[model samples]
Target: MLYGLIICTITVIIMSTVNIGLEFGKLDTEVFLIILKSFPIILIIAMLLEVLVIGRIAEKLVHTFSDNTDGFNAKILFTIFFTVIGMSLIMTVIGGMLGKGISPDSFGSLSHWPRNFSIALFCELLIAQPPARFVMKKLHLRQEDKLDYDFD
Candidate 1:
């Protein structure tokens, strides 16, 4: 859950920055304001979608393919694989609808769905997961040392 929150925070900011800039043909001060308006809605939905839906799917899939011999890296990779693919597919369309409304013309954005998926996959791989993993590791270490933390 903590891991998902960190990843969502990073990915939402980066994805919103890029997508909003593409929409307006250039970045400007106004884009950040728009993001501020939209960010909480997007982030909450994304966190719920990941935790409630995609994360469960990924865990199941990982347990299916993984054996006792598989290392932590392999399991983590499997989780990343399924989760990112699932999140990318759903969020691309959801993002469009949330931002643009569901007109027939809005469905035209499906044409760019592949591009959106590619960007999301790369962003998760290159930008979000690394720092999220780092934070989780630190938290785990703190836990092992008998330190207590509470997100709630």
Candidate 2:
């Protein structure tokens, strides 16, 4: 639950900010307000989906791909790749639909989802996940079993 919450919060904030900027071409008070208002809705949905869906799938994938003998770097890379792929696909569809419903004029068509998904995946891998892991470690919020991997 803590993992889900942290990831969801970071992912939503970064993705929302970038999407809003892309849509509006500028960040203003009005846009900021819109992002703020939408944050809870997106965050809640993301958290639920992460906990119920993505997290389970990711755990299974990691278990299948990683053994106790696997190096920490290999495990981390596998986990991140699985997470980015799963979350990107799910969030792109959800975000695109919500964006269209919320402001049809601002969001482009579904055909643009590939680009959006790529950007989100890139941001998650490069920006959000590392910082989130650091924060979780500092706060002692990470589960020992889930995060622990043999560094050797």
Candidate 3:
């Protein structure tokens, strides 16, 4: 859960900025203001979508692939893969909708969704995960606590 929150927050921020820049061509003062103003709402929507929708879907995918017997690295890779896919899809749609609401000319079409998705996937896998994992490790949030149960 903590991991999910960290990843979702980081990915949302990066993806939102990148998508905004892609739509507007550059991040000038006006664009930055748009970002600053819209950020809170965007983040809220993203986190809700991630936690309530994507996380459940990713967990189901993960369980289908692994029986909880894989090594930690394998599990992490699976989680990251599923998460990147889930986040990219959800964010692309939501961003497009919000962008359209903000400026019809700027985000006029969904033609750029593929490009946006690729950039998001690449960033999540290559850029975001390393630091997020580091932070989780430092905070002792990476390790799962196993509970032993006995019936007599």
Q: Candidate 2: global Cα-lDDT?
A: 0.75
lDDT of 2 by residue, 30-128 (tens): 989989998999898888777788767887999998999999888877876777677767776677777776566435455556765677677767777
The segments of candidate 1 whose C-alpha lies over 4 angstroms from its true place after superposition are 147-152
lDDT of 1 by residue, 21-63 (tens): 7887887779889888888998998999999999999999999
**After TM-score superposition, what is the CA distance of residue 151 in candidate 1 from its true location, in Å?**
24
Clashes of 1: 0
Model 2 alpha-carbon drift over 4 Å, by segment: 102-110, 141-152
State model 3's lDDT.
0.73
Clashing pairs in 3: none
Clash pairs detected, candidate 2? none
Q: Tens digits of per-residue lDDT for model 3 on 29-118?
A: 998888888788877887787778877888889889987679888876787678767767666666777877556543544566677678
What is the lDDT, from 0 to 100, of the residue 7 in candidate 1? 94
Q: Looking at model 3, which ten-residue stretch has the lowest summed lDDT?
A: 143-152
lDDT of 1: 0.84
Return the candidate ranking by TM-score, descending: 1, 3, 2
Estimate candidate 2's RMSD in Å. Answer: 6.3
